[model samples]
Target: MAIASSQPNSPAHPWPSLVPKTGMIVTLLFVLLLLFMLDIALGSVHIPLKSVVAILFGNETGQVAWEKIVMTIRLPKALTAVIAGSALSVSGLQMQTLFRNPLAGPSVLGISAGASLGVAVVMLASGGAANAFAIRQLGLGGSWLIVLAATAGAMAVLLVVLGVAVRIRDNVVLLIVGIMVGNITVSIISIWQYFSAPEEIQDYLIWTFGSLGGVFGSQLAVLAGVVTVGLLISFSTSKPLNVLLLGENYARSLGMGTFSTRMFVILATSLLAGSVTGFCGPIGFIGIAVPHLARSILNTSDHRFLMPSSALMGAILMLACDIIAQMPGTQTTLPINAVTALIGSPVVIWVIVRQKNLRASFS
Candidate 1:
């Protein structure tokens, strides 16, 4: 990423100051590292920080049980947290920039809801018998099934939004269309749940609560791969995204294809948000809250900086939340979704309150 020109009179939209933000960016990366190690170190069973470090470096920890917990359980969980946080945060940043709305996010736009619906169709809408039949006979089970279904569902919603974007120039109207579409998706899922078997409902409910521990091995690899692609796609759009911020008409004047830009963003968002929802469930707040935090800290709208900044901030926040949800030193654990809501709700309120007039935020 190009650093903002140090020259004051440069005509190009100035990027955030490099000197201060570089330090902040480095600090955030340091914090992410600390949190990753901390998330692995703290759990229901206490493991010494030294042992955790040793195990990570392939040293013999001497205690097999501690080693197993660190390597098999905590390591994957912590990695998943980083991936999920970065994916959701960057996806949110893209959405906010694309829609030019402070509140625009995957969850807010119903993209996650759409993903959940796709999973629901596989896990809940079909009778347990048919689902089992498909899994056993067709070999369509496990992580791959859910991830594909979720991605498809998210893509479906994205297409609708894109269709609306083509004809409607007003962002407010587009935002409302997204919300209404998402609500419809949620309602459909609710009705399916109402008819689903109790056991099926229970399983789906657990998925909704969200868990970083659920992904491991091949599943973890898949999540990481998908999120990485999404992040790259978003990063590639930094220049176009900057032009987009000046409004579509100005963007068109500059020979940018507004529709094509929107397509790239939606595609990236689907991969990022959908894969996370499929593996980790519909994680909220990280997407909506992290971008604002990055913007506030960096004091610039440039996507090049905001993308990485949000990724680091999002990972930090997610790891911190995961630590809390684990309720270390106790067997009792809280749902990640609940903890995220507790944290994210206040941030949303802050965005609204601080903006005062919502429309002015985009302007």
Candidate 2:
């Protein structure tokens, strides 16, 4: 691997700046598919991989319960993990690109924080009856409220950030401003918790822990649709994203509207990150950690390859986290957010050790 980097770029690779990242990306896609299948098949009940595949193909697994479990429970959870993972990862990639900061991510920019604030407002302000209200009022459940509120809050904060980004030409200032937004949003959430009922506080806190299984059925479809749209937006902006990699000045000299492109990137990011956070409840770290991992693995900053590669990696990581968190036969599950943090911290440390000039690497 070291030799590959030390030598001239491989001819088989399309991008001259790096090694044969195409093979790695293809390998990742295969791994992601395998993980997706495993996520559905390997659970507490221990359905066989064959049965799972059969169930997915609309064939009964000969056991009613097996079919039900595969179709109803595990399938949706797997799909949720795939979509959420891809969304958060791409969101992170976009933020990292736009900010030209390796550490930038959905949460770093306070978009997730804003989503948290929205959830806090609902669960806390509504008191201990949030669950009942979700099941009763609004007909579609309280989660609908949470999703709407979170998306609203995220979009609102994202808009403010974009407005500021439009006026300010400096990425550093924008980065600090994003941190400040997170701090402010978190402070507000803390105040809400202080005044809320203990039960309400507990409810909000639990939601903050994040969950992949919370979404299923129509909820899963909604997540998939929104994530797909966001991804499409991302692909559309890929060329501009690649251009911006040379820094805003270089992009502008190429007749690219850096500010407008930044706005589109933010919009795509908010949709992707906000929707996932809304449904999954602020699953963190992937948005911060995955892009650098992708860049390091792909050995290039080109968004063309980086976008899909990161999405595939993110889906695999999220599925792996879900598999671990579920604990299979244990009948207990850990919080998804905790797992992400645990997984992400090591990657972050590796990035710090591995990257000499992190910002310049992205550029």
Q: Highest lDDT, which number?
A: 1
TM-score of 1: 0.87
What is the C-alpha lDDT profile of model 2 across 162-273, one tens digit per residue?
8888899787898898889989999999998898777677777788888888687788888899999999999888899888878889999999987778777878888899
Model 2: lDDT equals 0.82
lDDT of each: 0.82, 0.82
**Regions of model 1 farther than 4 Å from truth:** 1-20, 128-144, 162-174, 347-363
Tell me, by TM-score, which candidate is best. 2
Clash counts per candidate, in order, are: 0, 1
What 10-residue stretch in candidate 1 is worst by lDDT?
Answer: 133-142
- Which lDDT tens digits does candidate 1 get at residues 218-303? 98888899899999999998889988889878988999877778778878888888888878888888898888877767766778
True lDDT of residue 142, candidate 1: 41
- In candidate 1, clashing pairs total 0
> What are the runs in model 2 whose C-alpha is more than 4 Å off?
1-19, 127-142, 347-363
Superposition error at 122 for model 2 (Å): 0.7
